[model samples]
Target: MLGDMTASTTPATSARLRTEIPGPASRALQERRAATVAAGVSSVLPVYVTSASGGLLTDADGNTLIDLGSGIAVTNVGHAAPAVVDRVREQAERFAHTCFMVTPYEGYVAVCEALAELTPGDFAKRSALFNSGAEAVENAVKIARVATGRQAVVVFDHAYHGRTNLTMALTARSVPYKHGFGPFAPEVYRVPGSYPYRDGLTGEQAAAAALDRVDKQVGGDSVAAVVIEPIQGEGGFVEPAPGFLPALSRWCSEQGAVFVADEVQTGFCRTGDWFASEHEDVVPDLVATAKGIAGGLPLAAVTGRADLLDAVPPGGLGGTYGGNPIACAAALGAIETLRTRDLAAAARRIGETALPRLRALADETGIIGDVRGRGAMLAAEFVRPGTDEPDPDVTRRVAAACHQAGVVVLTCGTHGNVVRLLPPLVLPDDLLDEGLSVLDRAVRAEAGR
Candidate 1:
């Protein structure tokens, strides 16, 4: 139920289904979308959700589909959690958008304080807010350039930063994100990421190899910052080798280059930790976070070493709606929820249970090329047997079956052949198990085993 009597008003979380997946209502909505929305705004699954709870999404057709994708990992706390809803409603009532820069608010400072404290590295830190993950990343790069007084910005191959022009340049995939966009910003460079599954290079070897590219391609002295995702999100949920991050951090120190960790998809307890960099000994000089920061609200931030963050002149970094009061309030509530309810530990517990089941399924189905990720930020990459070629056909069929069976799933990877599982930590065990069962059956059938 909602105060508004029209659209988006239903039970906050209960999935009440009266028809099949795209039943009459959803089919109509999709038709409207096709007519009015740009074809470029495609979907992984043709679904229309009416409401969602801990682990279920009620479709427009009134069917309860297990939510294993978490809205592409945005609602890590689950949909419409009481804490977040309360904060959002209160803020919306009092003042939805006063703009942080124009009118200072406690909620903004409180969230910044949380970022300063929760992020890795004990050095004094400060934060700047943004409206999206890409905005945060853009701000981080600007800060690095200003802080180090260098021009070259180095990224890795198979990385996914965003859809904006600059980030499109930062991004590697060409089809969807960068397809009709061109004339990208210059001085951005790409090097190899420590991808053990494909590269088969050790941590030190990988670091050296990438640095060699820097010397030949970008030149370390000319580089302002080296940006990376702790767990390569869109490129494939690839975890770097054990010593990869630490080695790179040391190199950044030696070369006087800023190390920026784009934890946009892996932060805020999504990966069983406040920050994925904490898993390794590496502490990034700057960190960018967004997706799950404000419990589904569009709030993002760049927290970094105080001195580096301070290098920019006043007004060098900020957005009009960067720290909207409502988003800040939601962030405060989200952080509080994580602490009071122990969601990070919950993520670890869920991963501990899920990784085994997924690995077992992978063993049973050779189509599963790899299963890698930390905590609930997990993925299973699909490949044709006897070779490492991506099996996009099988991947699509598996996802289609999961949707037909009343479970929401998502696909990723450079090749669009990875099935990423982003179930909320607050999901009930029964619901979680049900989704996995569906996934198992789908995988078995797709693999034809």
Candidate 2:
């Protein structure tokens, strides 16, 4: 119940910004954090939220802040969704824990079954459950290595795979996620991502260059899997070039490498489809999903080809708390919600509305170097005026200004200069416009200063 118990049953209609960005309550929390909490754990904006629903977070001090970040895209269905709440209540009342591995349940099986049917690749598929995106990613690598009988795992530059030791090795960042931690998992490799804005490489060219690097470095044959975030979340809302994914898929096939798409942040309609891989019609050997999979519950899953997944011997990949009954129940409810509401289409509609305005902003403001993303998973990367050089300082100023104006914004990128916006698809048009206006004002004001 990460953000649960603190959510308001009713949505905040009037968003109020009081006492600057980190108001009194948030300031107190920050003080407590520095004193009591481990320095290893930190926060960007220490706003203590008391409640959240739809697209607003109510701070402990009664301030309503528009949630553009969607709790790191966790609540794509929106906070405290009625469908998810009902399921959680019913499941908690009936049965909460009772680990899947200890005593399997219908809910667990149903989620996996749903995954098999939903993920890309018409071929037979299978799935395993885990607790977080990192865990799911780790399990995916395990499966890939076991299936291919190879030890080398290829990751991409600017990738943010999780904070676990194995996933840490898989991740590319060094400061926050991998700074002090060392001696990470071995046999992991990194390749250039198809970053059109920076690398000036088309999807096909980028893919070719990456494959060539793999050929020279890991010799493709020695690689077990090449895991990528279909639409990178933490490494900025970067989408692989149109041909990049498919080309990589072809290479993996030729080299006998398992293709793993870490769709933890882009799945469950956040990217306007069941998963972003479907955009290019490319299917990976394995898919790791989490974040939006269970409405807001803590659940992650790995769905892959049946033969490759089955390569793992019986009782090979599992966890004590993986796929708890409560999480499974929540996931079932979430899937039903997505289908009934057609949230994928909803996400596309949101993107349609947001893209034009963000693009217009890019045209008007030289600081906005690029706007990229698919569906509701969108971002605006800020740079110095008339230059592609990322400006993290301006990004922070704009984000803070948004907070002061009653909007919560999240900045992400390799240089920390991208202000990502993952608003809930269920957001009302008026609210969405209002949030956009705040962003506009914040950007304008920050640039003016």
Candidate 3:
């Protein structure tokens, strides 16, 4: 249904099953990957993808599966989007890498300009590009420290910042991300984050508890920055209750600590807003962004108050490939698509279509403990029937069932009991409906079991 594909095209069908999930061809590739790939680099589904377009992925065995994860919230405009493809091709032909740090280019400056206009601030802003979200987050911390002349950085519970040594200290999870990766960076402190579903507290109440801990344990005045994801990502798509962000931001201002919003997963219209902080009218001093910024290219940025970023020395904040020309080109095209298509509203329509269905499913299935999220980023948390205890086994089964049925779904959360759906904003309504129908039956069967 993207562009003008004929109905007879092999991979153009909304969703098709040519063979069993991970059919023979994919199984063969799996055997090859097992021998060469690292054990820690795991994938949700083992199917080997050959090509992707719009909402469908054509696998090695000719199976066409619907994509619900969007490469972990990348490809938001859609896979191989025409605008992105064109820009990438044009940029590749002209030039690829002339690192922005050595020989600055317009694409890099243009992307920074776009970030200035698009991010949730009307004040003068500056940005430094990076190669990944982790890099951007680390750089944001560096900028905050340099600007505020403080050492302590405060993060929230159930947060997933990154996997780098410094970011691992900033991250709250253990196991796969931070386990055995000590000793981490120093001066990183953790406090409570708002989770209305589990904590059962109003935004102001949760904020007070967190602020109290910050003041008592960390001493807010000593804090360089308070970093948070407007909505938690890998710890589950936990959108904080209303007013929590505003309260923390005000506290940061009063305490002379910078407020940093990690918008890596919630930015670029993925949450029906350019940045999630806009939802609560909260303006952070620095915002780290990535994932959906470049339509699949690896491009990250730390955009914030000009004074904060300007405080850092020139050589103190750059990398060899921080803003690769090709990635910047891709970002420009992706941003253009988001603006022209009004994908922010499209994301809202996606939420409108999917949330009700997910909520109805929650009501029908006792295992579904909660259903929450915004825009195209929604999730269903699984729990043992009649209890709030997490049911990760059932969650895995449901996701496996969806995969076998030619639908790709991803699971997240500290307990691994969440099924988070992040469909591309450009996905056709019929494909989304069909994918949801498959998910519905999968959940019903698994819950019935």
* Number of the predicted model whose TM-score against the real structure is largest: 3
Q: Measured by TM-score, how close is model 2 to the native structure?
A: 0.96
lDDT by residue for model 3 (1-449), tens: 22222335534657777677888999999999999999999999999999999988988977788999999999899999999999999999999988777788899999999999988779999999998999999999999999989999999888999999999999998988999989999999999899988999889999999999989998987999999999999998998989899999999999989999999999999989888899989999999999999999999999999999999987999889899999999999999999999999999999999999999998998889999999988999999999999999999999998888888999999999999999999999999998999899999998777
TM-score of 3: 0.98
Model 2's lDDT to the true fold? 0.87
Which RMSD values do the candidates have, in order? 3.8, 3.5, 2.4
Tens digits of lDDT, candidate 1, 1-449: 21122334445342334555567888889999999999878876676877777777776766667788887788888888889999999989998777777778888999999999899989999999999999999889999999889989989988999988888889989988998889898999988988888889998899888889898987778989999998999998989888888888888898899999999999999999988999986799999999889988999999999999899998788888999999998898888888888889988988998899999998987989889988889899999987789988888889888887777888888999999999887987777777888899999997785
**Against the hidden reference, what TM-scores do the models get?**
0.95, 0.96, 0.98
Q: Candidates sorted by TM-score, descending order?
A: 3, 2, 1
For each of the candidates, give the backbone clash count: 4, 0, 0
> For model 1, what is the error of residue 335's alpha carbon versus the real structure, in angstroms, after optimal superposition?
0.6
Candidate 1 off by > 4 Å? 1-18
The most accurate candidate by lDDT is 3
Question: For model 3, where is the 10-residue window of minimal lDDT?
Answer: 1-10
Question: What tens-digit string does per-residue lDDT give for candidate 2 at 1-449?
Answer: 11122435554564565456667888887887789888877676788988788888877766787788887888888888888889889989998888777888898899989999999988998999999999999999999899999999999999999999999999888988898899899999899988888988889999989888889988988999999999888998888778999999999999899999999999999989989999999999999999999878899999989998899998998898889888888888888888988999999988998899989988887789999998998899999998999999999999887777787789999899999988887877877888888898887876677
